[model samples]
Target: MKMLLTVEIPHEPFNSLVRGGKAGEIIGRILEAIKPEAVYFTEQDGMRCGVFLINVENPSDVPAFAEPFFLNFQANCKFRIVMSQEDLQKAGLEELGKKWA
Candidate 1:
């Protein structure tokens, strides 16, 4: 199974998580551990944001990984995990990720 992980947030979220800070380092490690097929983010106003997908072997395992993020940020975010097809033609995976990205 292949997974596409999407982390959507306001523009500043990128800075808080990836701009050479301690939090950034922690996030980098988390991303590496997850080994998401891809990573993408988007801008939302007033700090509200959305994360699209985080593919994993067991779809149910998302919360285990997600809880840390929520705790770290003290923010509200939504997550969704969907089983994907091995064949791209049938899965339409590329098109799906771009819809939100």
Candidate 2:
């Protein structure tokens, strides 16, 4: 099944994890290593955050991926996982249509 993992992280944790020009590098390495189908980042209420959509061979990978980030990011960070199809419906995402862009 495919899963969409949304992570809310503090700006300091993000800054501490990587340096200038290195966020992309870290994300690239993570994608290459973990092989998530898609990854996205955004700012919310002026806070740094991200979402990762991945196709997994088994259900267990969900917690596996989440744990590391939780441990590393720690302070005030939160993680949420949604099965792609179900979440889109619940959030009325389909109704947004092309406006998602």
Candidate 3:
């Protein structure tokens, strides 16, 4: 399934990493491991943040994706299932709506 991974990194440790010049190295390592379909870096809620689109073959794989941020940056991480246009078209929404309506 396609999943969106949002990570909000707290200022303290993140700042420390930046000051120590290790932030890029750490983040690079994590990104290399995941090889996300897409990734964006930005600020959220006044904190450093990263948004990643990735494919997760199984629910059990979530921890592997999350642990790097958790351990390195003490990040707040969230995951959500997402759909492409093709996936949305394939969903049986019409039948479900008719059944419920």
Query: What Cα-based lDDT does every candidate model obtain?
Result: 0.57, 0.64, 0.96
Give the higher-lDDT candidate: 1 or 2. 2
In TM-score terms, candidate 1 sits at 0.50
Off by over 4 Å in 3: none
TM for candidate 3 is: 0.97
Model 1: residues with Cα > 4 Å off, grouped in runs:
1-20, 48-53, 81-101
Candidate 1, 2-99: lDDT as tens digits = 44444434445455665656666766766676666556545556553434355556768777656656655554555554554545467776888899
* C-alpha RMSD for every candidate: 8.6, 8.3, 0.7
* Local error of candidate 1 at residue 17 (angstroms): 7.9
**Residue 80 local lDDT, model 1:** 52
- In candidate 2, clashing pairs total 0
Residue 15's C-alpha lDDT in candidate 1? 59
Q: Which residue pairs overlap in candidate 2's backbone? A: none
After the best TM-score superposition of candidate 2, give how far the Cα of residue 86 lies from its true spot, in angstroms.
12
**Residue-by-residue lDDT tens digits, candidate 2, 24-43:** 66656556766767778887
Candidate 2 residue 25 Cα shift, in angstroms, is 3.5
Ranking by TM-score: 3, 2, 1
Could you tell which candidate, 1 or 3, scores higher by TM-score?
Answer: 3
